[model samples]
Target: MELRHLRHFVAVAEEGHITRAAERLGMQQPPLSQRIKAIEDELNVQLFRRKPRGVELTEAGRVFLDRARATLAHYDGAFEATRSAARGEQGRLCIGVLPTTLFHPFVPLIIRAFRTTYPQVSVTLDECMRAEAIDGLRNQQLDIAFLRSAIDEEVDLNAYPLLNEPMVAALPSDHALARSGRDAQSLSLKDLADEQFILYARKLGPSFYEATMAACIRAGFTPRLGQEAPRITSALSLVAVGLGVSLVPACMQNMTMNGVVYRRLKGAVQPKAVLMIGLRRGDTSPVVRNYVSLVRKTAKTFRPSEKEAR
Candidate 1:
């Protein structure tokens, strides 16, 4: 009839005595007996055979006991699942990421750490271009995004800085600089003035585009534009084919293109490339918050200068 009725029935069935069931339930024997009687009357079936000493379950009582236990167990499981989801321990998190962020070692490190901490939470990732990732965050299609550069401050999102590293030149292995056979300690941006330059699309990262152009201008020559690719990795692929040299985030050195070599760039001021995480400013999802907290902790170990580079 009710959960309490099932519970009372179960207690009496297990103890095989109304007195003991009442003691176990912390209730009086009379109330427990009445509740058990009400359940049997509602069902129109005999649940027990009363004996001089105690009682014994009838065939119907055994069957009802099994069903009652199952129902209670099902309710308990549902309750736990709901609580876990609310705690962010078990749920799905959809993340949008720029392709370049995958090249950074810290990206995987943080992801692995988060997985270890919340193994029950399901994580799904989408590798998107800057524009797409931004749109996804704005539309609530993505819980968070890892970006190559910060979005405009006017956007209604919070950007958390993750990594800051200087730009490096990706040169064709057979090119003069790479074949000089010795790694130069550092080279200025002016040195590449005459060489054709491969770059990422301006729309993908306006800040990086401005920084590169400003560095070249400060070095006394505008970069000779050769080709533009949608992603930094694509730009590197172009460099490997000897189309032209490209400047990429230093962490991209981890990306190994067969014919490409990464060389540090030095100048009056070396422009730094930044990796950031973007999330809706009003997001209150516990899983997203947990991930943002982990990113902040990971950023702390990148050295104070890199942390402040943004």
Candidate 2:
């Protein structure tokens, strides 16, 4: 009926002697024998037969012994699992990540390090848009999210600014800037003033969309917006084919599409894309707490290496 009863039953069954079973259980012989009798009465079946020197298990006792042992084992496992969860070593962590931020070095570094540190925690990644990431955090569907900006409207949503990576220009392989030896070193935003630009819709990621437009405007020209795509990666693909050029997060340079070359921007003030982690204000789950802590530590050490993506 109870875990202690199952344990007592198993110890008695295994030892096959009342005195020995009590010694194994660190209890008295009389109390152990009475506990075994109580189990049979509670089950409404004869589980043991008295013998001259010891007790013999009846057929019913053998069956009950198996069940009792199995029950005790399961109880032990459940107890340990509960402790593990309390320790933040076991649980599910659902993360909603913006598509644009998903491939960044900061994002993956946190995920890999968290996975290594809490191997028992289940980490689920949902690659999503900025809006979806916000919604997931607000609705409690996601434990945390990685994105370009923090949604300040929701009082319950807490944002931690991770790192800022400079936006670089994605140029076509045969484009003038890519081909020019001097411009090849670094290109200014003003250099792309006359070229057509591919812009992904703001709804896909408003932070990226705004950063691109703002950089171009400050450079002294309203960029000729020629093509529009649903996503930044799609816009980059368009740029690869000479349709247009686009500004993207520096970390995105790792995509390595054919005909696409990434160049640093040169200026006193350059556009910077930010990566932020958003979470609910009062989430107290150990798994979530561990992830947030790991994220902060990782962001501190995140350095963009050419091979960090690999």
Top candidate on lDDT is 2
Q: Please report, in order, the local distance difference test score of every candidate based on alpha carbons.
A: 0.83, 0.84
- After superposing candidate 2 on the true structure, give the runs of residues whose Cα lies further than 4 Å from its correct spot: 41-56, 193-197, 213-229, 307-310
Residue-by-residue lDDT tens digits, candidate 1, 127-214 = 9988898889888899989887777673688887777778877889888777664555457777788999988889877766777888
Cα TM-score per model: 0.87, 0.83
Q: Give lDDT for model 2.
A: 0.84
What is the C-alpha lDDT profile of model 2 across 165-238, one tens digit per residue? Answer: 88888899988789876657688888888999888787767787788888888888888888778887899889
Cα RMSD (angstroms) for every candidate in the order listed = 3.4, 3.2
Position 181, candidate 2: lDDT: 69
> Weakest 10 consecutive residues, lDDT, candidate 1?
301-310
Clashing residue pairs, candidate 1?
A: none
Best by TM-score: 1
Clashes of each: 0, 0
